[model samples]
Target: MTTRRNFLKGVGASGIAFCSCGMLDAARAQGAAPRSTPVMVKGKRIKTVDVHAHCLFHESLNLLGTEEAAKVLPPTKGVPEHFIVIEQRLKEMDAMGIDMEILSINPFWYNRERDLAAQIVKVNNEKLAELCAANPSRFGAFASLTLQVPDLAVQQLEDAVKKQGLRGAAIGASVMGQDFSDPKFHPVWAKAEELGAVLFIHPQSTPQLAQRFKGNGWLSNTIGNPLDTTIALQHLIFEGTLDRFPKLKVIAAHGGGFLPSYAARGDHACFVSPQNCNAEIQLKKKPSEYLNQLYFDAMVFTPEGLRHLAAQVGASQLMLGTDHPIPWEQHPVDHVFATDTLSDEQMAAILGGNAARLFGLKEV
Candidate 1:
């Protein structure tokens, strides 16, 4: 079987630039030495899965051609000897005690024309399937969808999961400026529900908040990403999308944004000012109660934060996640282990059990 290391070696030979030279160069500038192979923890090996991991769609970029690819992808100053070197990725995974990573590429073609978006989705899903096939032991993927065209998206989801063997669909919190709560997206949600596919909601930069997030702090990604997720989840809750698709398996990145943290406020708002909420959309449960039906990743970066998320949503709804390749949460397993709030069973679930069950993996 072709392993992740072998597949990435092929990717490197094909000249696909997965990591930007600037990022690697910056690491070298900091005098970072080559990472050594990681030591396994004593006793039984815990199967840890990282639900939030990313990679470039090299095949899709090639299909887009030079100019369009440049428009879609970030520019790099120099060609590094390797990009997403599989051996290196494995070493890091070992170091962090992550047994597997579910890869995804947040579609950047949402604003493109329907035909262009479809093409991008096709190539992306195909490439993702190929990668997962090459390394079934260590990798799985969420399919790309063209949410702008809901009908096409529904069909694409079916093809990716049924034919290509992807686990689910990875979607931005919103398509272009359109929120997922829009009625037109109900078809896509229904399809996902029917397929029992996990819908991973990873937010894009909130362009609407660009003005407030400007200058020095990288707030476009820092504050803007999580803020966008918060808004998206709120819309799903308040606008009745969640109520409509009650069985939808949605996984919210960054600990379900800020909603899980301040969910009581939503309940209070609904109680104090019924007139403020949509009277037409009556929910069966309180807004906060709906949180139990949703899932979150342990990427909050603090023990207290993860504990709060677990307390609100329950550990059963929380899973392991590291926004890998971006250098966040480098010690995800250790982070979960260090959190005092979780019991041994809760820690086991967050580390890998929940993810294994959700993704239908039998390895654990």
Candidate 2:
């Protein structure tokens, strides 16, 4: 049972704190007490794995030049620097009881020139591989791709996984303003399917919604981020990309966004307006049928939210994900453990079992 007190303890007051003021104040109030670690289950230590962790690539920043990188990245204090120190990261992981984290850099160079994008991809992949190599047991990585140039993206994926030992690739929900469902991205999808790479779809705040999201609250991240992911997943489902690449191991960040909560609407839409639904791209299954084919992270931040996600997508398809280096869900393993809805087996699987199989982790 996840009581409100337990939830607040695991995530701090920041768990329920939505606005910037609340977050900032909560950080100051919480002080520097270490978080409680994951508990032992059945006399065994649960091997916790976080599939949605992020890292900064300083080399890429240097390549892009400070001015260019600053434009794309958020103007946060000590971001890339905070994530770069290996000792600091390991200490935090140990405190949180996370045995491993699959690192990824959300695509920020998607709109850059082909050559610049390729170079950024190369540098990011190399740095990530190096980090994983240094901390083989504690860290794994997803390669960054130049999706604006699909052919280059495909080649980069192959090289990254085969040669670099990267687990998969991390991509944004969209390329510039273009959705993943666009035919131009087919080659990249096909290559990912063939390689059996885990394509992690993370969102960069949806630019189209900037005007609407601007205000005192961080609606851009609170609403815009998940909204972007929702749009991307819908396109993939309705536009036949999932049907085309059924075997692609795709993981949607932020608990598959709003899709899981309102998936039945897709089925209703198809049935109600068959003419609006493309017959050429007619899905062999209902739009919601694809939910089971995809995977989601347990970053919803509440027991009820996580329970709803599990019901929609099943426990087997849900993995522990903490948008790390960010203060969201500080104690991720504990958050999953706090959920009373999941059985001990289901809990174990979400914490690490599923990720071990998906990423081919030998340690588990």
Candidate 3:
């Protein structure tokens, strides 16, 4: 019954400040928004496990073995060249103090053409496998899925994980305007939960809202992305997707897009009207209990927000996510260490310990 507009009203200016003040200060201090060199963490330096870094591949050089495939992809943001190699990525990771990066392509580049999307996922997975083969310890992959075809997605997921040895899967907040919580996606969620796989849900800018802000270009990526995440989470919670697939290990990016801050309102609304939802799953606990079950990334970009997210989700469920290749957000490790509220152990967990546990990353 609660609309998206009313939900966003709760996460106003204070919420934005809570999530982004520290990085804003760092950028403001620099005069120009400059990238900071990754600092060495004192005491026992946490092995940084960045869950949201990205990469581009030579689609021409892919198994498809045609230059046209590369041409289909719109140009990536950070890496301008046609081919972004693994070693160059390593240098950037080193600069950012990221010991390991979970690589996946941004979903915006996806063409809804199902066959092409399938080919793209195959090529991307191959590229990732090649990288991990070269530098096994330094990288893990969040395999792309051709969600346009759920059965194909399941097949690719099996290949990516069982055959290619990738860590898990990465998905967009929505597929073709349909939310992940839609009944059509039950098979996808069931497969992911069955594998005990980590599903890293990333936000792509909303397609529908793009026309609304045609002149103000910033609205799509800046506002629409978080909005997309917020909408997706709302659908998952209110529609009872989380209740049905309780075992799904969902890792929501952008600190769950202000979901923790708005937990009270969501639970209250759900309590007042149960028939509004689709799935019949009920819980003795509040909606906050469901949030605690879901994992979040430490890309919220401020000490206060990080403290709040840690308090909300618990340190064990918080992993590092750098919106890498997107220069706007703060670097993951720096943001985690900057938080005074997190003790040494908590900081370590956010940086890498939690990720290690989640992905079963062997400690170095």
What are the per-model numbers of colliding residue pairs? 0, 0, 0
Candidate 3 per-residue lDDT, tens place, 126-216, comes to 9889888888888888888988788888988888889999988989999868888778788888888888889988888788888875675
- Candidate 1: regions farther than 4 A off: 1-44, 63-68, 71-83
TM-score of each: 0.85, 0.89, 0.82
Q: lDDT of candidate 1?
A: 0.78
Tens digits of per-residue lDDT for model 1, 212-289: 898987888888888889999989988889999999999999898878878889888967997887788887888889
- What is the Cα-based lDDT of residue 58 in candidate 3? 66
Alpha-carbon shift of residue 41 in model 3 (angstroms): 6.0
Where does model 3 exceed 4 Å of error?
1-42, 60-77, 81-83, 108-111, 272-281
TM-score of 3: 0.82
Model number with the top lDDT: 2
C-alpha positional error of residue 238 in candidate 1 after TM-score superposition, expressed in Å: 1.3
Better of 1 and 3 by TM-score: 1
Cα deviation of 36 in candidate 3 (Å)? 11
RMSD of each: 7.8, 4.7, 8.7
lDDT for each candidate structure = 0.78, 0.81, 0.72
User: Lowest-lDDT window of 10 residues in candidate 1?
Assistant: 32-41
Decoy 1 TM-score against native: 0.85
Q: lDDT by residue for model 2 over 5-41, one digit each (tens)?
A: 4544645643322122213345447652344344444
